[model samples]
Target: MSTLKILFVLYPGVTHLDFTGPHQVLSRAPGSETIVASLGGQDIEAEGLTFTNLADLSKVDRCDVICIPGGFGTTAAMLDEAFMAQVRRLGADAKYVTSVCTGSLILAAAGFLKGKRAACHWAWRSLLEPFGAIVGEERVVRDGNTITGGGVTAGIDFGFVMLEELAGRDYAEAVQLGLEYAPDPPFHSGRPELARPEILAQVKARMASATDSRSEAALEASRRTEPA
Candidate 1:
């Protein structure tokens, strides 16, 4: 069986869980090969954690799947033309183009998600409008070859679905079994609609600055990529 080559785009300020959660599952697939690619192949610091040995973007010629992760740094990436050029190069040929959380915003900025129904972290869902995407509420949204997950934690769920699509249900189930993938969160307030007023206010306040930056960057990217 041919190995499934998966390229994960890692950048500074990444939310580590967004990359690692899905990575843990996808890497374990029977014939999967995972490559984490970053600008200049340098070591990256992700939300206070360091990741080493990331491949340089130029080193990759092609990949079956391209996964992008999200974090505060996504705002900067959206504004980077050189970075988005590499993203467009890789995503143009990938069989499946996927993202976790605000990563969708990056994909949209790269022009890979125009007019697609995609999901993103709820706090930034409005940003998708500039990309012409139909925002979805589901944890994972798949529109043709583009698949996007909602928020950082949704990567795990997104991985399982991607595995099932690539390797079949039985294979994905076995991976789930091995990982003992089951959720029983003590808190019942994960989403804005579910969280108490005070809790939601605190979370929103914390993210306000980052969200504003992302909005500005996403809008600019949308304008740049619009059909003339």
Candidate 2:
């Protein structure tokens, strides 16, 4: 069987877990080759670590899958025509288009999610309507060849699902076992509805600035890409 080429779109300030969680699964899947690319070949910093030696966009011609991870920089990326153009170019012919968290916003900005049912971080789920997507509440939502995951931790589940699609359920389950993917969170407060009211308020308060910026950027992107 031919190897599957998986392209990961990287940028500054991307959340580490959003990228790494899925990567850990996809990289281990049989006959899969993972490639990381950015606008330039320079190093991009995430919340904690720096990703370096990334392939330049100009050099990556095509791939079987395209995965975009979300983070604080996703807002800035929505405003970057060059980056979005590259995304459009790369995603135009990919077999599967995928994203985690706010990365779906980037895909929507690039005009990829129009009329699709997709998922994103709960905090920003409603923002996708302007991009013509039916927002999904599930941790992992797949419509046609497009798959989107709901927040950072959802990437792992998204990854396993992708693996199953690529290989098989058995293969994916084996990989999950190898990774010891069982999760038992100490607190049942992962999402707003499940969290305490006070905790939800505090979380929203802390994310106010980022939410405002992402909202503004999404509006601008929608306007610029509107039917003309």
Candidate 3:
């Protein structure tokens, strides 16, 4: 088989972990090349970290896999016509369409996830309704060629899942072993369901502004597109 190209669609304000978690794993895939691109090949600042010298989104022509990582900038990225245009075009031809965190929203906005069982950050999962996405609560959800991961850390899981699909279980496990992919969190507060009620409340309160704005943006983007 020819070498597989896995391309990451990046934008400003991306959660650093969301992109790197998967990149770190997928980059290890045998016979695969991973690339990162952004608008005009400009630098991107994600959570204060800067990524430079990226491929220009418009200039990227093809990929076997395309991934969009989610972040605080997701709402703006969804609304950007040029960015979504690139997403739609690449996704149309890719063998696997995927996202991590709110990145699924970008896929939804591009009309790639309609009637598709996908995953996204739990806090914003409901936003998928506007784009006709069927929410999957699992850490990693795969519906045909579209695979999505929930929240931030799920990207690592997403990487391995897709890596196994492209390669095989043994190879994936081997990579996992090489990377020591074991998880033993000291805190049990990762998800809202697992967190104490007060803690969840505090997070929700802090996120209210972005959540509300993102909700409106999703509705608007969905309205602009014809349902698939």
Candidate 4:
């Protein structure tokens, strides 16, 4: 059997769980190989950890799957025309293009989400429609070749879903068992809908600030693309 090559796109300040969680599940699949690709062959920092000498995006020629993770950096990445072009090119060549959290924002900026049903973090779900996507609030949303997940931890579920679609249900089940996929949140406040009203309000306020900043960045990027 041919090995399935999976490419992971990363950037500075990416959320650790967004990529790592999915990687933990996908890497365990039989005949699967994973590679970390970045804008350049330089080290990037994420959640206080440094990943060194990852594959340069410019050099990636092929991949069975492409996974894009989200974090604060995604706001900047969505604004980078060169980066979006690269993503568009690579994503076109890959069999499956997937993202977690606000990473879908980058894919949208690349013009890859056109007419696709996609999911993103609850904090930024409204933004996807501007890029021509039908927004889905589900933890894992699949629209044709595009798969998106909500928030950080959703990557795990997204991975299993993709695994089932790509490999098989049995393969996905075995990997889930290997990871001991059981959730036991210490509190019932993990989801925004289930959280206390005061807590939800606070979280929304913080997310609003981030959203404003992301909007500004996207606008700036759009301005840069305008004919001079």
Candidate 5:
């Protein structure tokens, strides 16, 4: 079997689990290779965790699959014209393109989500429309060659789904069983509707801050021609 080369785009402040969770699973697939790509040549810090540099974005030609993770860094990445252009270019050559959480926003910014259904962290779902995507509420959404996951943890489910698509249902099920994929949250507050009023309020406040920051970055990106 030919090896599947996978490229993961990472930046400062990225959510480690968003990429790592999926990478661990996908890399376990038979004949799969994974590389972490960054803007320049330097280590990246993710929520106080540092990841060694793997490759520069400029050196990548094509990948079998590409994954982008989300966090505060995604807000800046979405606004970076050069980054967006590179995403667009790479996506065109990739067999599959995936995003977790608000990383969908980066794909949207790159014009990859147009007229496609995609999933993103619920807090940022509304913004998907601006990029011409049909925002889906599912934990994982597959639209043609684009696969998106909701929130950070949903990347796990997304990986399994992609595995089933790439490998086989039986293979995916075996992996899931090996990983003990059964879930049973002690609390029923996983969704917004199940959250307490106070908790909901706090979440809303945090989202408001993120929205403001993204809006500012979007404005700046509109004014600038390319990323620095």
Candidate 6:
């Protein structure tokens, strides 16, 4: 069988779990090859963690699947012409185009998500609107070949969904079983709607600064770029 090449695009300040969660599952797919890359094949500082030995984004020609992860750096990434250029290049012909968490904002900035249903981290989901994306509240939203996941933790669910689409239910199920992919969160506060009022307010306040900055960036990116 031909290999399914999967590219996980990375940048500085990325939320590690956004990429790694999906990477853990998708890398195990049969006949699939995973390529991790940064803009310059340089080391990446993801939150407090560091990732090295990444492929140069510009050097990578193509892939069957292209995955972008979200982080505090989404605003910077949105404005990066070179980074978005590579993203557009690889995504233009990829069999699947995907993103995690706020990564959807970057994709939306690329003009790929205009009028397409996509999910972003709830805290920043509204930011997708300025880019003309149909914001979805679900953990994962698949519109045509473009799939987007909500928040950081949703990448795991997104991965299995992508796997099922690429391989089949049986294959995805087997992989899930092998990974012991069962969730039983200790708290029922994963979402704003579900969290205590005080808790949600505090969390929202914490992200207020980033959200405001990203909202402006998203509007700017939307105006400057056209849908590809």
Candidate 1 stretches with Cα past 4 Å from truth are none
Candidate 6 per-residue lDDT over residues 1-228, each given as its tens digit? 678899999988799999999999899877889999999998999878999999999999899999999998889998999999999999999999999999998898887898899999998888889888899999999999999999999999999999899889999999999999999999999998899999999998898877767878888898877545
- Could you say which candidate leads in lDDT? 3
| Prediction 3 TM-score vs. true | 0.98
On the 0 to 100 scale, the lDDT of residue 117 in model 5 is: 99
lDDT of 6: 0.92
**Candidate 1 residue-wise lDDT, 1-228, digit = tens:** 677899999887789999999999899766889999998898989877899988999779899999999988888988888888999999999999999999999999988887899989999989988998899999999999999899999999999999999889999999999999998899989999999999999999998877777888888999989889
Q: How close is every model to the real structure, measured as TM-score?
A: 0.97, 0.98, 0.98, 0.93, 0.92, 0.97
Give the number of colliding residue pairs in candidate 2: 0
Candidate 3 per-residue C-alpha lDDT over 14-99 given as tens digits, one digit per residue, 9 for 90 to 100: 99899999999999888988999998998999877999989999998899999999998999999999888999999999999999
Ranking by lDDT: 3, 2, 6, 1, 4, 5
Which regions in candidate 4 have their CA more than 4 angstroms from the true location? 219-228
Error of 4 at 139 (Å): 0.3
lDDT of 6 at 57: 97
> CA lDDT of each candidate?
0.91, 0.92, 0.93, 0.85, 0.83, 0.92
Lowest lDDT sum, 10 consecutive residues, model 2, at 40-49
Evaluate residue 180 in candidate 2 and report its C-alpha lDDT on the 0 to 100 scale.
90
Model 1: how far residue 132 lies from native, Å = 0.6
Alpha-carbon RMSD of each model: 1.0, 0.9, 1.2, 2.1, 2.8, 1.4
Error of 4 at 130 (Å): 1.0
**What is the C-alpha lDDT profile of model 4 across 120-184, one tens digit per residue?**
88878877776667899899999888999999999999999988987899989988887899989
* Model 2: residues with Cα > 4 Å off, grouped in runs: none
